[model samples]
Target chain A: MQPAVSHGDRPRLPIQAILRQTQDLPVLPGAIMRVIQLTGNSDATSRAIADAIGMDQAVTAKVLRLANSSFYGLPRKVTSLQEAVILLGFRTVRLIAMVAGTFTWMTRPLKGYDLPPRQLMRHSMGLALGAQMIARIGQFDPEEAFVAGLLADIGKIAIDNCIDGKISLMMQLGIKGGMTFEDVERTVLGHTHSEIGAHMAENWNLPQEIVEGIRWHHNPLGSGNSWLAHAIHLADVLAMVTGYGLGGDGLQYQLCEESLEICRVSAEDFDGLVEQFVGAVLHGEALLEGMG
Target chain B: MDVRQWNLSFGSQSGGGLSSHQFSVGLAEIRVVNGPTLLECQGIGSCIAVIAYDAHACVSGVAHIILPKRLPSSSSDRPGTFMDTAVEYLLNELVKAGAVAERLKWAYAGGSDFVHLASGASLPALELGRRNSEAAKSELSRLGAEVVGNDTGGTTGRDVSFCTADGDVKVRTVHEGEKTICNLQ
Candidate 1:
């Protein structure tokens, strides 16, 4: 489908420029980071991870509630972090940390950019889920892919914070400036979100690949075709197209040649990926309907 | 602390590049010239680094480039002027710095071509990282510099530092010992 150009040709806001912001969407809250570390570490134990989860009252509450919630439908109340970890495996436990981390961030509002509190959260969580499907399809570590996809646009949140209400000004500049929003940011802000994110990654001590993925998702070209950068880039766009949670990115869909080539994404596959994602999101949304 | 002699890390196929360090991003002034020595770029992941060291003269140079190719319109970030480009470019810089291409030894670090091989569009093959390695290798061979050592592939991130004044190259991953990417005989 073609991108609809509105009357007056409303200038495109870069739904993507979030990729070029000055820093990472603030580091995962420290507690969440600890959980992520434990989940990713092979030496970490269920008890240890469970202990870590138990530290966050919110997550601890979520685990117990979800385990007993209608979703699991156990005969009796499943008590303790030990039971939750035993039932959920390390992989599932890691996923929980990711969700908890995601919730902590997505719950906030990214004003000046037009994303209502839950709007960006819904979009971010949706992308994260869809990215996992892509990872599974391609046979990589789906969980890690989910994290990559989930945090891909973290840079955008920075732009909203840095520029304030000027997001509208930047949006106007995007189409009129004949710039891909990135040009406008560089022109106004001196650096793009990608650089900011890479900078943020260094500051927050995130793994280089995750930082790279965040920095280059918008312009896969600069990332130099490193598979992690390229795959995550494509996953980001694909998730957007599927309409999982469209954010403030101006809905621009001019695909990058290098990213498409590296992902081997054809017209058919592109459409297929979107359809598959839309379905996946629908399934997840349905299952978690009762909960926020 | 194990006070081993200084070593270095270079690159061929790679995943990431120089992430953690006290060095400045615009810290663009140091250039290697003459001697049997080492060169380095630390905090490397998927990206590849290219090293050219002339052990006989105790001179060396190291470069770290992030991608397989630059964007079509990215004339600003020239591939030939980047990390690997700088490594290969060192030959000319070395000639000026008082060293010959034949006298130089080479090393590489931080490449895992298959780290995320799940994007299965494999016609071009799931070998972006290896292809990068191959590209760097071809360029080095063309320059007549002898490749003395390498640490590429497998899922690991490496930190590399080199000293051209003494012909040393050092590679450090999370748990692995510092191996010299350039162990020129």
Candidate 2:
């Protein structure tokens, strides 16, 4: 499907201008950014990581609340950042901070895509859990997969923001014409959200693995061929299948077959993984609601 | 508390109480409810929702069916998990809950693949949405059920609700506004 020029003479905005909007988008807080950095450093002590979170009062509050929340059911209250970090483990605390930092834009309703409030947040949570589950089964780094899954679709925000109000119309046209969302995105905007999201990640100075996961998530074979990307790809499909939070495109995105191999799972294993993913999403929902 | 008792005991005299109560039908689950209960299911992307109603008895049921058939190794005992068993399970439960099988009417929505490969072809596993729709039609016929309304196949998700009080099944799509796709009465 050569980018359908069928609409003829529709004024299209340049991709460069669209990419520029992502600069205004908020990146992860310094505290959480440091936590992410420390997680990858084997020699980083827990106290150093705790000190990083303690620097941000807001992150500290959220981490304590999550550690004390029913999801953890801690016997005693976590009064300080160090206690919260120790109680929840450095990796878990880091994830909490990331989720907190990203929650704002993710929960907002993107009118261009006709997505309801919290739809993308829910989808991201679902994908995060799905990626973690696959990581657990495949013996990979679950934390890396979790972060990758959570941010894989962050580019959609840029696309929706740049597209203005044409989301619903383009969505309708895609559905009516039987075009994949990527195809529709390319047809109307020249570049897909993956590229836009990758640009956003670059602007934020995110880790290379995270950037590749977001960029190649929809098409792992096309780019860096990162296993993390494959995990996010499979997770996204499973998220769509379970209908965790459907946006304008719904289940209209193609499922990448190589993901199964990337995750080292067969089709039957994929089915079991889906059931596990659903359970994790349900559990994650309670914590997310508590965060609200 | 049972859904019926919980609704009736707290129900408003103005007929507003029971309608406020909603029961969610999750993946591969089914529930039979009597009026004025509302049964809701969400995000039926590649899955299907089979809604059956007996208007006269105010007995309605919904099945959120996930797959076309239950694989032999599937450990789930829930009958509503597959198309082959969903309608029969729903019908049996409705009858046991006071609906007459002969009086039952069916309506369904969901079974869409909004995602497809760039080559305009679906991977074999990804084609389940169309296959699910086909299995649903065949299963409905096999059970001799009358299907009165249908909204299936597209590149979108549907949020579905079946009101037992009036047997009204409403479907809301992402781009399309909500509509009462079928009524069993």
Candidate 3:
């Protein structure tokens, strides 16, 4: 896609080129990647995944701590990594690892976006928890939706990096010009964080569903078979409204009515879910501190 | 100046980390601070933060308001959650804390229309920051509290701080650095 030719004389590059120009995008840790790969296999056992994760001493320690923390409230003292992994299940373990590995990137303050340190991470986890709840309401797999929501804004990091700390100017222009942050980026930079995030997700070799979730979260109607995407869209809107880890976007993005229809979410249901979602977000914060 | 330096001056005054004395005002919650303290309201998207200060009395408070008005059936005891009731609560609390009702000065922040589609676009279900701010202003006018200053409306979420000692209301956002919108002696 052609890059937006901002206000100045500087030549604008295409989105693909901008992605290539990014310096050292973070990657999943070897152990987490191995666990992700192993979990995808039907024959993979809990013991095998635990052994793979055990290779990373830091992650092993965090996962064990999280398992033992009151967040889980497991019946007994879980001594072994294998036992903790089994109790938490593969998806929860993977999320713990993902949160741990990406903690720094997720926690760093993004200029111009008005996100203080860990604000984006807080928002990401809030969205993840909200998405899980929405997915459960729809009887879908909450785990998959959780991961989708967690990484939906991964592109914002790259976009923030590419803009070279001039996001504040872009944000100011958007606010004065009556434009959404996504629209401002697309108009001046020729790409929104959503698309940039999708490229990063593809580079990381994440599942296609997750890739689409990141790409189309802002506009899920265009994405075919966007059940997961719709859940994320609602979760994001709800999170923003409730001020859960909110940042520069604030309440500026458009809420897609189609997403509500496709996802079958009612206003009444949304209200009820919000109360539970808030508690879940607070609980998730405790888990987040443990991950760090 | 950058936020860090501005924060540092406060840090030196108190001889502690900024986070130590900082308190967040949640939805509908009102926190009254009488000593040298930095009462904060973080990440206000469409919501409004109503800050009232009486410097002479050294009594100040912040209310994080989520909605524009309070419904008749609204049963939440925290009056600060609604614009209509927030000013009343602030006035009452200030008087109880030794602040003269006629001496109160108010400052507003964080009513942003970050999502309005266009200048003349049809209204969405909620105008959010705009409505909350308007309601607060109208109610404050009715109660006869002088609104000293405000940095309301824009697309960015603001982290606001009101220090009780000097009644300095500092507004910080990503688009704009830290600026003291309201400074009272």
Residue A164 of model 3, lDDT score = 56
**Better model by lDDT, 1 or 2?**
2
Ranking by TM-score: 2, 3, 1
What lDDT score goes with residue B185 in model 3? 48
lDDT of 3 by residue, A144-235 (tens): 88888989998887776667566667776776765556667776677888888888888888889999998888777657758888889888
Candidate with better TM-score, 2 vs 3: 2
- Top model by TM-score, which number? 2
Candidate 2 lDDT over residue span A199-250, tens digit each: 7787778899889888888787765558898888888888887677776666
Pick out the ten consecutive residues of candidate 3 chain A with the lowest summed lDDT: A1-10
In terms of docking quality, model 1 is: incorrect
Per residue, candidate 3 scores C-alpha lDDT tens digits across B25-93 of 765578887755678777777778888877788778888876776555454555766777777887888
Q: How high is the lDDT of residue B103 in model 3?
A: 79
What TM-score would you report for chain A in candidate 2?
0.89
Per-candidate local distance difference test: 0.55, 0.75, 0.72
Clashes of each: 42, 5, 5
Off by over 4 Å in 3: A1-11, A14-17, A38-44, A68-70, A73-79, A112-114, A267-279, A290-292, B1-19, B24-30, B68-103, B116-124, B134-147
DockQ of each: 0.01, 0.31, 0.31
For each candidate, give its TM-score against the true structure: 0.52, 0.83, 0.81
User: What is candidate 2's CAPRI-style docking category based on DockQ?
Assistant: acceptable
